[model samples]
Target: MIDEATARERVVSTADRLFYAHGVQAVGMDTVRAESGVSLKRIYALFPSKDDLVLAVLRHRTNQWNTGIAGAVADAVTPRDKVLAIFDFLAAWFREDSFRGCAFINVFGELGGGSNRVAEAVRAQKASFQCRVAELVRAAGGPGYLAPQLVLLAEGAQTTAAISQDPDTAAHARAAAETLIRCALGDSENAPTV
Candidate 1:
């Protein structure tokens, strides 16, 4: 018999991919069963409803995505570098063939109006991303206002990158972020742009 945890993992992973690729409303638990090979009864036992499965997928994906960003920024030697590295990470992600911008952004557009639960989950990812940026700003000795500005740049880059199918947009966003950071830090004119 498949272990409960393994089964749960497969279901969530499969659902995350489907929901991300095709939008949440397009995918159903039957499809999850078809792709994941978990029995329908087990899927129901694991997730009582499609909404429950959607929540599970979003929560799982948020953790997985955040972990990737944390790992990508881990090698930066300074807080400022860490802030810049976020765009670097996004650049890499945007380059992938499977890239379709932020999953939360996609989900919000799809179901944010009809479902409070979905809206909350989608909003939570944005909130968390902005919160992390604020923390990074504090660490970098930048003013509090800069974090939201940086988040806007990043979010805009993501939207443009997805819609325009251009990976270089990530670099563009990073450059803008650098300019904002330098200005906020009151860098001398001689400060070299990275």
Candidate 2:
């Protein structure tokens, strides 16, 4: 017999994969059950409802997003490099075979109008990400005002890359971010770009 935690993990991970590739509304519980190999009874017992499962998926994805960004930043040697590393992460993520844009944005576009919980979760995740960017901006000696602009660039890049199927969108966004960072932080013109 599978333990509750193991069953829950299977369901969430499977749901995340399906929902991201298809969409939140397109895939149903039965599909989740069949794909995950977790019985419907176990899925409902663990998630209680589709909304519950979706929320769990969002939580799982959020953990992944945070870990990726943190690792990217951690590998950088300087504050400027740390800030730029976010786009490096995005560029790499955009090139993944399974790339389907930000799950939070995808779900919000599909269900944000009808589901308050889903909307709130997406908003909270985005806010957390923006806050992280803001902190990085401060550390990089950029003016506080530059964070939102940088966040918007990153957000826009995700959407553009997903829709255009162009991994270079992140590089374009990275170039814009470098310019913004230089302008806000007063970096010399001779500073290397890239």
Candidate 3:
């Protein structure tokens, strides 16, 4: 028999794949059980409810994604490099055959503006990403306004790349972001010194 910890991990792993491949609402508890090979009773015993399970899955995915972004940014030697790493990371993601767009954005879009546990998780994750970008911008000596503009452009680029199947759109967005950073730092040509 599988231990409780292993069973829980299997359940979360299965749910994460399903949620990313299919919309959150499209996946059901039964599907999780079927894929995980865990009994329904066991799943319920661990998760309590589908919403609880969804939150767990979201949290797991969020941690993994945050770690990846942090790792990518850590390799950069400067704040400007770190900011540009966001685009580079997204570009690599677009190259993946399994790429299905941002899972949080997709779930939020599917849920349609509701205040629930899942929505709260999504909002927090988004805010965290924005905050990280803002921090990087400040470290790069960009003015306060530059962070929000870069965040918006980054989000827009993700949406466009996901919808239009045009990864190159990120390049345009990156150029725009660089210009914003330059303007924020009172430099017309070069990026800010950090």
Q: In lDDT terms, which candidate is top?
A: 2
TM-score of every model versus the real structure: 0.95, 0.97, 0.91
Candidate 2 residue 28 Cα shift, in angstroms, is 1.0
Candidate 2 contains a number of clashing pairs equal to 0
Candidate 2 lDDT over residue span 17-115, tens digit each: 999999989999999999999999999999998988899999999999999999999998888889999999999999999999999999999989998
Model 3, runs deviating above 4 Å:
112-115, 188-194
- lDDT string for model 3 (1-194, tens) is 89999999999999989988887789999999999999999999999988788788888978987887898899887788788778777777776777777878887787637547778989998899999998998888777788889889888887888888888877777778776776666663445333
After TM-score superposition, the amount by which residue 137's alpha carbon in candidate 3 deviates from its true location, in angstroms, is: 0.9
**lDDT of every predicted structure (CA atoms):** 0.89, 0.93, 0.83
Clashing pairs in 2: none
TM-score of model 1 relative to the true fold?
A: 0.95
Candidate 1 structure quality by residue, lDDT tens digits, 52-157: 8888988997897799779877978778888888898899899899998888888889888988998999888889999998999899888999999999999999
**Best-first order by lDDT:** 2, 1, 3
Flag clash pairs in model 3.
none
For candidate 1, what is the total of clashing residue pairs? Answer: 0
Candidate 1: residue 112 Cα off by (Å): 0.9
